[model samples]
Target: MFDSKHVRVFDEVVRTGSFAAAARNLGYTQPAISQQMKALERSVGSSLFVRVGRGLKLTDAGEVLARHAADILGAISTAQQQMTAIVRLKSGRIRIRAFPSASATLIPSAVASIKNQYPGIRIELSEGEPPDSVEALRRGDCDITLAFTYNTATEQPASDDVFAVPLLDDPLIVLLPVGHPLARRRSVELAQLAEEQWIAGCVRCRSHFVQACAAAGFDPDIGFTTDDNLAVQSLVAAGVGISVMPSMVQSFIRHPKVVSRLVAPAASRTVAAYTLAGNQNVPVTQLMLEALREAAEEMRRGA
Candidate 1:
């Protein structure tokens, strides 16, 4: 195989038309240039140049190589430039998958911050809950995934190959109708709502709710199930049923008729950014993680 350095030297010699001139242009001695040409000729199994009086002349093979050398060098230079731009965060694309609640609250701010700071970096976002989003990360379909897990002892830890960067603790709050007696209370325990009809969220959220209710010693009377936060709030506002929601989601959108209270047992989910192990160091990915951290911190302070 022809070495890239030798090909570069050969291209320079063809451009300058002489070993001495090529050496001067490349900051190498004439002897070094001659040696590279000899090695390149050996690799290609052909003489690339011949003496025509005091100047160099291209053989038939030399002419063919010369014709392709400029294109090769140009392609190599372009590749180098693109890699440099990516490394410097001047240009790149990051694929991000976030859970719905995060997509509404944390992701918007984080995406905006990254866009403002590095306009050349393109971001593609899609909404997905954990396990699905985690699967996407493992499949290389996404570079980063914003996910959450309930901070319960029964919760399973992330897989060994996944890297989780803790962003914040998103507390679960009770959403009740304005006329509900507990609406006037500062906080409500899980057991207090056992008798009321309940509206559940996504499957994982629903599972967590059940677990929390079980911990409180009751099987909740779930009357409605939906993944839409707005729908959940709307049901509560209409006095159809009460629901529990992430404080982050409540902060982003609230129904005027629904009142939110902190949970007495203080249940929360650990929100984090997940990437395939070792991908957190990728330039664009790292920038996004940093933006998420900053956004999460701001939300924490606001809360």
Candidate 2:
């Protein structure tokens, strides 16, 4: 019979793509991981991996096992959570991951509320971009993931097994230096700034900015590229270049010298929370989701 422990380790190796990484994630030594993989191969009577350049690629048998392993692990996780709920609801952990802005804005309130209500229940958070966070969720690294997409129809999770709940529409806004001529305007149309130099945060954000600009009939003259919103604000404040950013940024931090104006025609991204479809009704997850909805509603009311 195949050992479930060995199968778990094998699954981790496939998810992490390297024995060393799997070792670190699962708290095992590198050599131990290799030994276990060898044992697993002997038991299954097939080599599970092949060397492709400096990286390891899964063999046909490995691919089959990996697919089954994901379902097996997910079932195991669900079972464990259900069992934990029976023992006690107040003493458990929910792992969550989110993109940066939501981490700063929404997570704090939700986490605080959860902690205050159930002090014994622990909530852990990690930050990453939507793609990375979604990948982490798929690998069972996080229970909930907060993500956003400028185009909801195209950017949402394609897998039917993942459940997505729309939280808020984070409108794109223009950020300009305090002394800029456009700073005094209550709303800046995208076409009005067609000739101005632009600052973009990340590839995905830049793509959205470009699309919005294109819709307004101009290609932006991108002068600077960065992924840090604070740096983008600093650049805008210094009169380096104007920026297009989501409204959530203002809730986190704002540069005093930067003036924000709503974009005319109102482009926005939809922020959503994702989880395994099967986990939607899990008690702790439901509680956290409710907290997020409450926080989102408050933000909407205040805006």
Candidate 3:
């Protein structure tokens, strides 16, 4: 119940042996020091000092408090210093959850940049799909999430509890075997592949693909489903099935026998950094977001 300020004054009085001396040291009036001492005594419910002929003497309770004062003050001081370091970007930790493709592409560069710039920061990364990553963020298991949403009119907006930072748009690119009839074309239309077996990506992506195919007037015959970019490309290379994925994923993992072409009616996903509402402004979070934005910019330029 005792205030830290009052405890500080009490400790100073104990050290100096007089209210006037403690006040002089602390830059407070003697009466102010006396009032703080009285408040501290009331909080502890014990008499802390006794007058011993023009000098102050510590009572039993005062001795007990004095013994622990230095440790308490030292802990408070350490906490303050650590907080300052975090605010100044000198030291901190950021836990990030991102989807697989992004983890392989954007995350590596962004994390590396942040680590190189702020060596004292500790970054931990985990891979998950957008839904899982966002769940982890809301559960307070991660500081930031790298997620993507299919660019569609039906795509839901982020909830009120989350803040989304726009990174870059990753266009949906179709993957086909090198010798496939449409492989050499500048782009492929969804309707042209109505009879082709399909390899689907993640659940969200698969759903988007189906809807796009439906809009193009046919139901896709999906033969395999996997969230792995390398697996998707490998499947496409072997001519097992054609697939569509974010351009970022295609760029990160390319197969010699697989060719990518932009999809007609050009669908894409919006890649973003997601955080708890208001966490975007935190110094460490803000720094990581900036790194992500820069990485996205580089990818955009290269694309």
Candidate 4:
């Protein structure tokens, strides 16, 4: 981003279409422009421009250089903006962006832990689906992302750049309305629920449902598809349908008419905490992990 007078000259010459004009633009005089061009050609070992009717044309190398130079300068500007924002944010906030299931099951407990330990640090949280939240992380809008990983047959690997840390294994479960006929059964089988309409969650989250139902020898009868945990819970509460969901989603089932039962084959989602590959904010990340562990303990005790 700094240094290289030749880069400056190369950029100017390309923009103005002639060395003399470039010299006039940069106020460097024609000799200086020629000198910079010589140095640039020698350094890059490429004839970057071709002379044309009283004007200049970029060679392929020169065009490439021009494109890269613009990117480098733009990167420098972006870096300055980032540094300025960081300077303005005296106490850096730990921005936690997450998908809904993680937000419901993991964040509150993790937040409680961060609050207890890093009281001086600001904890900002946002929730959405995985793609948008991952974009937020890529854009420097969030510090961490808590997301779910399905253990089903259809589950694919996560993005390579996302540093996913295993927090817990959340098994999928079937939720039933309290007075429904299945409520009397201690544990429900996928085949048993085959005839029952399933309330679906996220699209990528379809693996759990697909694999579980496949085990029972039939594709599930999906009645409702949604991203909201509460909406699925509400549908089940109304006896509209039963749904298979990660156990962590249990945190959202509040209606008195509904109850969740762990599925028999033990389908699960591997809950993980994600961040950029080389992030230096270890302390808060550690705190968040500890909070997740504590929350896991509380959840295990059903407290």
Which candidate number has the best lDDT?
A: 1
| Poorest 10 consecutive residues by lDDT, candidate 1 | 150-159
**If the candidates were sorted by their lDDT against the true structure, best first, what order would they fall in?**
1, 3, 2, 4
Q: What is the C-alpha lDDT of each candidate?
A: 0.90, 0.88, 0.89, 0.74
lDDT of 2 by residue, 159-258 (tens): 8879888899999899999998888999999999999999988788888889889989999999999878889999998887999989998777889999
Question: Stretches of candidate 3 above 4 Å error?
Answer: 152-154
Q: Per-residue lDDT tens digits of candidate 4, residues 95-143? A: 8887776777677877876666556668888886665666677788887
Global CA lDDT of candidate 2, please?
Answer: 0.88
In candidate 1, which residue ranges exceed 4 Å CA deviation?
Answer: 152-157
lDDT for position 165 in model 2: 80
Candidate 1 lDDT, 115-157, residue by residue in tens: 8978999999998888788888888899999888876555544
Q: lDDT score, residue 122, model 4?
A: 85
**Which candidate, 2 or 3, has the higher lDDT?**
3
Q: Which portions of model 4 show Cα errors greater than 4 Å?
A: 1-90, 135-139, 152-161, 301-303
TM-score of each predicted structure versus truth:
0.95, 0.71, 0.94, 0.62
Cα-based RMSD of the predictions, in order? Answer: 1.5, 16.6, 1.7, 10.9
* Top-TM-score candidate index: 1
